[model samples]
Target: MSTSAKDIGRLFSPLQIGSIVDCVEPLSAGSEAGWALELLAERPELEVVPIERDGAVLGVVSRHVLEGIVESAWKRFWQKDLDAYVVPARRSVEATDYVDRIVAVDLADVEKDDPGWYIVNHRRAYLGIVNLRTMLEHLNHLRSLDLRRAGEMQKHLLSKKPDEDPRFRICFYNRMAHEIGGDFYRSTQIGEDRWLVACFDVAGKNISGALATSALGAIFACFKLFAYAGEAQLTTGLLNALVHEVNPGDVFVAAALFYLDMKAMTVEIHNCGFSPVLAFIPQENRKIACKMARPNLPPLGIEDRMVNDAPQLIPITPGLRLTAYSDGLTDMTDPFGERYGEERTIEYLRTLHKSSQADIPGLVGTEVDKWIGESHLADDITLVDLRFL
Candidate 1:
C-alpha cells in the first residue's frame, strides 16, 4: 500500500506528530551490527529499532534477534551485517501487507485511528518512522478522560438506604478504594414484614473487577421485585449457576446474603466464602460471629455443585443488629503497613455498641478512614447494618 506525498502531508497535519518525531533514530541496514548492538545495550529500554537501507525498511532487530542471528547463522550475521537474522514483525495493529516488518497503519489511514505504530511511507518508500510507544501514551491519555464519568455511573447504581420500613431498619455504607471497584450491596423489601440484604465483593480491586461487579449488580437488580433476597438457597444456587454460565474467568464473587423474617423473628444468613457476619445483641451484651453454615464451600464460580448448602438461622429479637461487610475492612492497612484485622474490627464494633452509637455503619466507615491514614486503601469497603425493632 503506497501513499502519495499529498495524502501523507494530510495525515501529518491531522496527527500533529511533530512534537514526538525526534524520539528515535532509525538504523540503516549498512550500519555495523556490532555498533547497533552496543547502542541497544546502552539504552536498555529500546528493545527493537527500524532497519532501513536506501530509504527502504528491511525489518526490525531486537537484542535477542541480533544475538540469536549471530549464534545460528554465524558466518552471515557475525561478520558485518544483519541481513540473515532480521525477523519480520508480525501485524500487531491495522497494518498493510507488503512488509518485512509490521506496518500498523499507513500515513493515508493515520487519521482513522492512531492507537499503534504506523509506517510513514511515500510512494512505497520509507520516510522517517512513527513509533508505537508514543502512540500508546497518546491513546492512554485519551482513555483517562472518561473515567470520572464512569465513576459517577457506578455511584448511581447503588441501592437506596432503607429507613421507612416499620418492622426493621438498615444503614448502609460503601466506599471504593479506587475510582471504581467491585464492592456492591442490595437491600429489598418483600411484603408481610420481610426484608433481604445481599453484600458482594468481586475477586479483584480495580477496573476489571468493577466491570464484573457492575454487570452482576444489574442481574441482582432483578431481585428488587421483593422476594429473592430472603430465598437464600435459591438465590445463592441461581447466582452461582448464572455467574458460571455468563462470566468468563477464574475470578469469583464472595457474598453474604441475609433474609430477615419479621413475622418469625429470625434472620436466615447465607455466607459463601465472605467475611463473617457479626450479630450484635444489646440484650446479650456481646457480638456473636455467625461465621457460616458451610465455610469450606467455594465462592460463587468455583465448582458447578452446591445443592446441599443452606443458610443459618438466628433468632431476631429486640436490639439485635446483624452486620455484613466486605473483606476490605478487616484487611485494611495502616500507614505503618499493619493490618486492621478481625480482632480490631470486632473490638471496634463492641466499643461502638457500648458507647450507644446508634449509627454503627457510618461510624465504622469513619474509623476505616482514620486507620488508613496516608496510605491508599487496598480494596473497596462495604458495610450493611440491619437492626430489628
Candidate 2:
C-alpha cells in the first residue's frame, strides 16, 4: 500500500537475527582503538562485531572492518599478519547488565570494581551497541517520496493487458533489482504487410534502467504512431533510423525486429542479440524448427559493428507459430544453482507445442516456475508468440 520506513523495518527486522551483513568499513580488535572509533563515527547505525582474544572485548571492529586503514598505516598491521578479526558475540547477561548506580567507593576499592557492561554467555564477547537514533533515521530515509514513485511506475509497467485475440500474444515480466529495471517489450503492426515485435534490456538497475527503458518505450510509441499512420511500414532502415535518433548510453536493448508477409508466407527478421527464436509448425508434428538467422549483432551503443548485417529469411508457412524471447528466460537459475539454459527452454517449447493449446503464455509461465521450483523470478522474462493460422 504505502512505502514507509516502518514497512521496511517490519519486513527486515524479523530477518535481522543471524543475517550476515557485510561491514561497510573495517575495524580492528587491537591496541589501535582509533580504528574502532573511526568506524563507529562513520557508520554509527551498524552494530560492530567485536573480537575476543583472551575473553575480553579485545577491542572493537567491523567486518569491512578496516575502512580506517589508510595506505600509509597498512605497514604496521601488514607486518604482523594479524589483520583478521571477528566479533565476540553475546552469551548471557546478569542482573546488573541493565542497571546503573552511583556507588561510593574509595579510589583503592577500584581493584575489585567490575564496571562491566552486558556479558555474552558468562564470558565477555563484544556485540557492538546499537545506535537507536541512527537506525531510525536510516529506516525513515527509505520511506522517501522518490522510492514510492518508482514503485508505482513498476506496478504500471507490470500491469496485465486486456484479454483480446489479435494477430499475436505478447507478454512481459521484469524482476527489477530495485523499484525499476531495464527490460521492455512492444508489438505493433507497421503497415498492411509488415509487423514489428521487440524486447530489450538496459544495462543498469533502478532509475538509470527505468530511464533507458522509458526512452526505448518512447521510441517504440513514436515508431508505432508512424506505422499506425499507414504511410510507411517499418523496415530495417526505419528501425535503424529510430535507434540513431535516441541519445546514446544508459540504454542498451537486445531486441529482434520481425517483418511478416502473410501473402508470401515469409518472415524477415533482424536479430540483435536476442536468442532462441523457436519456430514450430503444427504440420511438422510440432517439432522444434530452427530458422537460419544471422548471428546477433552487438547490443546498442557498445560498438558500431552492427551497422550492416544480413536479415535472416524464414518461410512462415500456414499453421506455424513464431516465438522470440529475451535472455532472461534462459538465464534463470534454479534452487540447486543450475541454469534453465537455452536447451531446456527449447525442450519446454516443444512440450508446449505438443499440448496444442491456443493459450500458451500462461502455460509457459507455469512451466518455467515448475522448473525453477519457485515463483520468485529474478530476471526480466518476455515471450512473444505469433501463431499464423
Candidate 3:
C-alpha cells in the first residue's frame, strides 16, 4: 500500500546545515589576484572563493572585490598575492549543527562589508562553504516542512472519534485557523457507565499553542491510564497542577470537562476559563429552554492549586443536549469588523434545538461560514455536542 501524507511527514529526516554545505575548491593564498579574477570571470556561479594555507581555510575573496580592483586601473596590483584582499570568514559553524540553531547566532555582529557566507567545519577541519542567503532560504523551507508535519500530527490526534455507544450520541467539529492550532478535545470511557469528555484551548497561536496542546495531550493520556476513582473534580485539580508544572509562565489552558454517569443519570461539568456549557431542555409547545453553566475557576497552568469550586450538576433526562466550544467560535469576526458574539451564537443554537433532523455541528459551521464570509478565522474553532438518547 502507498504511504499517506501523514506517514510521509513523519518520515522526514532532521535537517542539518551540512545538507546545504557547498564543497567548492579553495584557492591557495599564494595565488595571483589576476588568476583569481580570470577564474571568477570564467565561472559566474562562484560568488566567493576560499583562500587556504597549510591545509587550513584562512579567508575568502569575492568576485566583486577583484572587479573593483581591475576597474580602478590597478594593472600592477593584479599580479600581487591575494593575501592583502582576503576577507576573513568570521562566521563559521559546524556542519553537524541543526539548521534551526542558526536563529540564535547574532547575524548583526558580522561586518556589512564582508560577504555573507559561513565556513562549514567539522572537528575544526574546514568542510565547505554556505552562503548566508542560501542558508536563510533553507531555514525557511525547513520551518515550513516541520510546521506541516506538526499540523499532520495534531490532526491525527483530533481525528479519533468517540466510539459508538448505546447510551448517548456525541459529535464534534474542529477547524484550525492556521496550519496548526491550540484547540483540542478528548473522549474516554472511564468505567462501564462513566464517560469523560473534555475540550481545551491553549493561549497563543501556531507553534506556541501547538506546543502547549501537545503537552496537554500527553497529560491526558497519562491521566487516562491511571486516575483515582475517575473523579471529575480530582482529575481537574490534577490536570491544573500538572499543566502548571509543564507549561511556561505565559501559557495556560482553558478547559471544559463533562463527566457522564449513566447509572446516576447525571452530568458533572467543570468549566475552567472556557466558554460556558450550554444545556438545552425541550419545553412544552415545541419550545426549548437553554441554561448556561459558566466557568467556576480560572484557567489551568495559571496557578499551582485549583480553587475550591463545585462543578455544576445537571440531570441527564431524555431529549436534553449539551454543547461546549472554544472561544474561537464566538470571537469570529466579519469583514465589517463585527464579532459573531455569544448572543448570536446562543440564538443560533436555539434555532437548532427544535430541529430533530439537523446536523448540529454542520449547521453551526455553516452559520459561522456565512457570518465570516471571505474573512479568515481569528482563532482555532472547536465545537462538541452531547445528546442523551
Candidate 4:
C-alpha cells in the first residue's frame, strides 16, 4: 500500500530539507533541447529538469516551456544548446536547513506561477532539488496534528471538578488566549472542614506554559498524599522550591493559595505576585463590605527560599465570598487600547456581591466580554469564587 499524506507528515516532521530532497539525474552542459524533451516524455512526472556544469547547478527548464518551444514551429530551437533556454535559479538554500524553518520563511515568497522547486546544497555542493509545495503541505499537516494534541493536553489539565462541600460553594471560570495557555487552578479537600484552593499563571505561553502547569499538577498530587494539617507555609515553600528547580531562571509562576477552614471560620491566603484576592464580608446593617488582600511575596520560581513568612488570615463569616483571579482580567485592553483597570475590577466585585447572583464567575465573564468587544485577549484568564454558606 502507498503511504498516506498523514503518514508522510509524521515520518518527515522532525527531519531537515535533505531528508526529502529529490535526486534526479541532471543534464550536463552542451546538451540539446531535444534530449530534455525526450527525458520529460519518458518520466511524465518531472515538472522541471536541472542543468549542471562542472558539478554546479546552472538552472532549470520547465516542461511547459519546452513543449511550447516545440509546438511553436521553432524546430531550430530544439537543435540549439539547452543553456540558452535554462532559467537561472533565483535562489539556493542549504540542505541542512530545517524543514520547518524553510516552510515558515523561505517558501513564504513562492507563488503559484513561480517555479516551486528549490536548489538544495550541502557544504557548497549541490545535493538535490526540493519541491516547496509538497514540503509545505506536509509540514502544515504536522502542525495541525501538534496543535490538536496540545489542546487536548490543556483540556485534561482542567478536567477535574472542584471538591463538593455542603458548607461552601465553589465555581471556576477559565479562557485561554490560544488553544493552550498558562492559567490553571486546583481544589483539594484535605480535611472535613478544610480545603485548599489554588490558582497559578505560568510566565510562559502555549506549550511552555502548558508544560509548566503539568509539572505543578504532578507536585500538587504528591503533596496531597501527605496527611492534612495546617501547614500552608511549608506547602507553599515546597511548591516554590520545586517550581524554581524545574523551570529556567526567567520562568516563574504567579499564584494565589487559599486554605479555607470552616470549623475555625478563617481562610489563610498566600499571594505571590498574583492579583489581589477580594473578600466580601456581610455587615449587620444588611449591607456588604469588600476588602482586598494584595500580594505579599514575589512570584514563585524566582527565589530559592519563600519570601513571605506566613499567610494573611481573614475571618470567614456565613455570607463571606472570596474571589481570586489572574492578572489577565485586570490587564485586558479594549479595541481602542484602554485597559480594564484594577479599579474597575474592584468596583465590579463590590456591585456583584451586593446582588443575589449565584453564578459569579459567569457574570464576570459576561462583563469582560462586553468590555473587550471583538478584540482578542492577549493573555489567559482564570477566576475562582468561593462562598461560605
Using lDDT as the measure, the top candidate is 4
lDDT of 2 at 18: 10
Instruction: State candidate 3's TM-score.
Output: 0.79
Order of quality (TM-score) = 3, 4, 1, 2
Model 2: residue 27 alpha-carbon error in angstroms: 36
TM-score-best of 1 and 3: 3
Q: Write the per-residue lDDT of candidate 4 for residues 1-389, one digit (tens) a residue.
A: 11222243433334577667665667876766666788777667678788887777878878887777677665644445666677777568776688777777766677767756778776787766767776777687777788789889878878877776888888878988888889999988767778889999999998899889999888767656775454678778888999999999999999999988778888999999999999888888988777889999889999999956756998887898998889889889899989998999888877777555467767888988998999989999898888888
Candidate 3, residues 1-389, lDDT tens digits: the string is: 11121232332234666677666667888876667777766567778788888787877888877777676766545545665777877678887787666745745565665446778886687767776667678778878998999999998888876744687888878989999999988888777688888899999889999988888778767656775355677778888988899888999999998889889999998899999889997778866688998998899989988864666899988888999889998999998979989998878766776555347767877888898999999899988888888
Model 1 clashing-pair count: 0
What do the candidate models score in CA lDDT, each in turn? 0.65, 0.52, 0.79, 0.80
List the pairs of residues colliding in candidate 1: none
Scored by lDDT, model 4 comes in at: 0.80
Residue-level lDDT tens digits of model 2 in 290-332: 5534345655555433464555677766566677766777888
TM-score of each: 0.64, 0.56, 0.79, 0.77
Encode model 1's per-residue lDDT on 293-325: one tens digit a residue: 334346787667566354578887777777777
Best by TM-score: 3
The alpha-carbon lDDT assigned to residue 283 of candidate 2 equals 48
